[model samples]
Target: MKMRIVPIGDQATLGDHRHYPGARLLLVCSLCGWDKAYRAERVIDRLRELKSGGHATRLEQVARRVAWNCPGCGRVKWRCHFAWPPGFDDREAKRLANLYRN
Candidate 1:
């Protein structure tokens, strides 16, 4: 199955994955050019383990709450987004990409 990248809105929470099935978290660091995609379920479980409110945590809040610091530069800059199952949409992807440009 093809996967499509989804723009994570400011109001999005970890639990929101239920509304968009097969979605994953995409974390990007602009400063160091570091990026990683994580499975949403795994992230939720990890958050629960850390006692950080798990699914209730908003995507925007994740950077502050999680250790998303760039490994290369050790900076705490991140652009959070989502990846979902479906065919890719170039237009939507481009728009989402632009939203994180600094």
Candidate 2:
């Protein structure tokens, strides 16, 4: 995989992603407090996904903003995610792996 440099939350970093081709994305939703992690290459990819497949209308508005209210929870804490360095401690790594299993 090519190491792509994308700007995220005012910080730029190299990451592995193909969906978003130019800039990195960090979404902090105010709806569900899910704090989703996304590596977006451009604003358009996020917008397009929300407009088409993701079914998240809330995400579309928060695309370039640092913080916004989430649609799910009616609170910002539950719905937003920001640019954070992805270093998985052992426990976190294990927890994430569990998501892939049945």
Candidate 3:
């Protein structure tokens, strides 16, 4: 399923995806087929820096200029997505058992 990542405000106001437990920030580089999932909280930290002293909270704007330093294939540009589906990963399994439950 396609996930939606909506960044609504600054780190202090919007907080991190950690509040969602299993949520992760997925970075995919079409150029090299690089697909990696990083803790959303940590990814937000880096994104805060990439904000480049701007007050804008639009993630797409900030991410447009961000680049990932791919150790396997040197520096590469990547697109970001948020994922918090059920069965995300071992690290988040226990906490996200009720991910989609009503």
lDDT of each: 0.72, 0.41, 0.52
lDDT of 1 by residue, 8-96 (tens): 66888888876555557877776876767788888889888888778888887876665655788898878667776456566655665
Query: For each candidate, how many residue pairs have backbone atoms clashing (under 3 Å)?
Result: 0, 22, 0
Worst 10 residues of 1 by lDDT: 93-102
As for TM-score, the candidate ahead, 1 or 3, is 1
Give the runs in model 3 whose Cα sits over 4 Å from its true position.
Answer: 1-21, 47-56, 68-75, 89-102
Ten consecutive residues with minimal summed lDDT in candidate 3? 9-18
TM-scores of the candidates in the order shown: 0.67, 0.28, 0.46
Evaluate model 3: give its TM-score.
0.46
User: Between prediction 2 and prediction 3, which has the larger TM-score?
Assistant: 3
Clashes of 3: 0
Q: Which stretches of candidate 2 lie over 4 Å from their true place?
A: 1-24, 30-33, 46-82, 88-102
lDDT of 3 by residue, 2-96 (tens): 44344434342213343455656666664675666766556556657766533223434434656557665676666655555543565664546
Clashing pairs in 1: none
Assess the local accuracy of residue 50 in candidate 2 as a C-alpha lDDT between 0 and 100.
58
Q: Could you tell me the lDDT of residue 50 within candidate 3?
A: 67
Angstrom error of the Cα, residue 48, model 2: value is 6.2
